[model samples]
Target: MTYTALNKQVQSPLTEQDKRIIATIIQRHADEIKTLWIDCGITVWVQLQDGGRLAFDRNWFAQRVAEEKTSLEAQENLHRQNQRLEAELKQACTEYGLQHGEIDYLMFSTKVYRGRDLVGFVGFHRFSQMWTYSRRATEPDRYARSASDALAKLGVRQLTMV
Candidate 1:
């Protein structure tokens, strides 16, 4: 089965306080090495290179960072894995023919590599009320999965033909 993302259950723009909090979250993530993918409502998805998804509560993120800091080796390995995962994530997006606008929300999927060779991945998908619809959202099943399906078939075709 394939993944289908969710749209907003309500229509609402972010409040001033919400913007501030969002900005802080963005800024904090921006300073780090993590990459962030943002899905605004069900209408727009933007991949931010400077920051990872900011959908988490501030304290939770802080706690994670603190825990990570306790082990220097782990932190280094994690950073390496993040770098590899960033590339693989981009590749998956391309291979699957997914546009940045198609994502419903942010997912922090980590990729691991060994000596420039990618190994595996893990992901954190955030489902929260952070974005408003910039435009009316189309039905989630309508368009998003088509590209992924087509791409998969295309891959099989190429492999078989080769």
Candidate 2:
């Protein structure tokens, strides 16, 4: 049945069990609930301090619980992958004798280093939708290429040395 049509069936007020289920779903899927509501045209209302009532679609709540579970699973998988990449990056840095400071800056900050020395800074070029490493325009390409390769192993992509 359509949601609009089902909305008129106020005779069957939500039971205590239904309220419990809804509360559980909301707590478990707080992150995905907003997008789910917009996508499914689900409405939610809450009672104010004075006197009012809250309404929402039970079907939508159920669907959101399922979808949020799937979404959270995917996110967990991605997080695992990222963790693996981070470990690999750490090992690579150790083997290459690269300083941890350089790695940290590359991963977390916009500062760019030239062979263990901070040469310049990097910025995202909005027009090109790519990162621009600014400094040492005449330097050999090998250093930049090596740095890019290291970052690539850490799941960083589309970095421009220029």
Question: What's the TM for model 1?
Answer: 0.23
Candidate 2 wrongly placed segments (more than 4 Å) = 1-58, 101-116, 119-162
lDDT of each: 0.36, 0.43
Query: What lDDT is obtained when candidate 1 is compared to the true structure?
Result: 0.36
Q: Local error of candidate 1 at 1, Å? A: 78
By TM-score, the best candidate is: 2
Best candidate per lDDT, number?
Answer: 2
How many clashes does each candidate structure show, in the order listed?
1, 0
